[model samples]
Target: MTSDPTSDPTPGSTPDPTPDAVPPTETVRPDWAGIDRLPTLDLLRLMNAEDRTVPAAVAGELPRIAAVVDAVAARMARGGRLVYAGAGTAGRLGVLDAAECPPTFGTDPALVVGLIAGGRTAVTAAVEGAEDRTDLAEADVAALALTPADTLVGVSASGRTPYPLAAIHAARTAGALTVGLACNRGSALVAAAELGIEVEVGPEVLAGSTRLKAGTAQKLVLNLLSTAVMVHLGRTYGNLMVDLRATNTKLRERARRIVAEATGADRDAVGRALGATDGRTKDAILVLLADVDAPTAAQLLKASDGRLRDALERARHQGPPPA
Candidate 1:
């Protein structure tokens, strides 16, 4: 006998009749069926094994991540900002990454921006259905005053969150380059943006709790995106964070070490250079490596668009300071 189309599918049968409708892997994990009965040790082991798969998933999306990084760097070089929008874990991750940029890359606080769906309060406590509010996302992007030169990245673990989808649409309308980052393939978030990065991390061991492996994958991707873009923008000198703003004791010591290591200069020489450049690590390195005075080093850096390697080459071509 034929079955009723509207009736629920029997256990182990197809849940949805639509061929194009597939359940998100995040909501279906066969291995987690008897997880509640497992011992604490075994549960931890299972979680760890599942967590190990996150890096591999991220690795598969490296090419796409590289593309986004290059695009973001190009825009940033033209005075554009990198903006990230999302909700919950995704939003917190964006905020954390943006917060680190200032001290890590010497970027202005306004350069990298993170907008959460429920505003500041959402970062710590859940805002209750804020992720489903598309209007809030639109308002957040509008307040940014986006331009064509800016790049906006919308992050969502489900890939169907209304907040990020709305932000992506609003950002695109403002002529900003939009990138959608999601953990599921063929998501609305991905389809709506000019560039999409989907890292399929599969199901969570705890069932629907995306803050586990999915969160890890998002963090990994964000790390690569921001770090690579900064590297492309000359924020580093051969893997060293030359653009670091040494605001505290630890960073101040790091700045001195970076200068000494980059220029083979002694402690006193590093201190002198740091003082001359007002604790600017890149300028100190340039001053020492180019064997030029502070003013000349600053000029060379400015001429080369703050690229240390380019400034060094220019200084080399100019020959040694008049003996």
Candidate 2:
């Protein structure tokens, strides 16, 4: 909760003469006054009702989200990276999404990056005054060495967070595509970037605790952004993650099931196909569906830029590689 300037001032610290207008996420709801007096069930119901409004707020930003996804996909197609920068809850969310991309969509760990204000330690513990450090933000962006082919998304609930704003400015200066994701409109963070997505989730149930609805909105937006970009980059085949990296026993079993589902093959055939392809699910599917050897399937996938559907079409048209 933010301190009221009129109520009290820190020792030896004078309040600013001109305070900025309160952000929607920071504003208290008059109707929610004395919410502490409510029963547990009533409180739960109130919070749940507020949570339901988040999706509609996100829905209103669809066109903006689509544009950012297309832009990010094009850059990534050329080997560029997608980076997310924020602080606190926003920062943690970005890191989580980035870390998941490799296992879920078979992307290089370096291809999607996340930077939080105050470095790695802040991810688990609060680093006091870290979010206010613009220098740290600039240094973080500099370390990435971003290029025009890269995209950086700055996330914040208030739209005025100094860390993400500075990071966005530094990325823009580096010729990278800059996008701002915030829960409030007309924010400095939004104006600093080339593209802006504001979900406008309004006030949270507990007033300024943006980690509730704002965090949810940011997570949803990041989900849409990363997932849709992967789809456009051919990491998926008809809603299936064709490029999934199965690194564990469960994932290995999943890989077999996916190959079976895609090829309509029995378990034995799936096992044989997976073995021939070295357990590569996409290659196994291509080998079965296109009636090609493992080596030919690999070549087709490479030619089609790892797009399973395209490789299958090419293989069908070319008949079979030499017997």
Clashing pairs in 1: none
CA lDDT, every model vs. true structure: 0.88, 0.90
Top candidate when judged by TM-score against the true structure = 2
- Each candidate's clash count: 0, 0
Question: After superposing candidate 1, which stretches have Cα over 4 Å from the reference?
Answer: 1-25, 319-323
- Mind giving the per-residue lDDT tens digits that candidate 2 earns over 83-138? 99999999999999999999999988999999998889998998866777778889
Error of 2 at 269 (Å): 1.0
Q: What residue pairs clash in candidate 2, if any at all?
A: none
Q: Quick one: best lDDT, which candidate? A: 2
On a 0 to 1 TM-score scale, where does candidate 1 land against the true structure? 0.90
Candidate 1 structure quality by residue, lDDT tens digits, 157-191? 87877788889999999999999999999888899
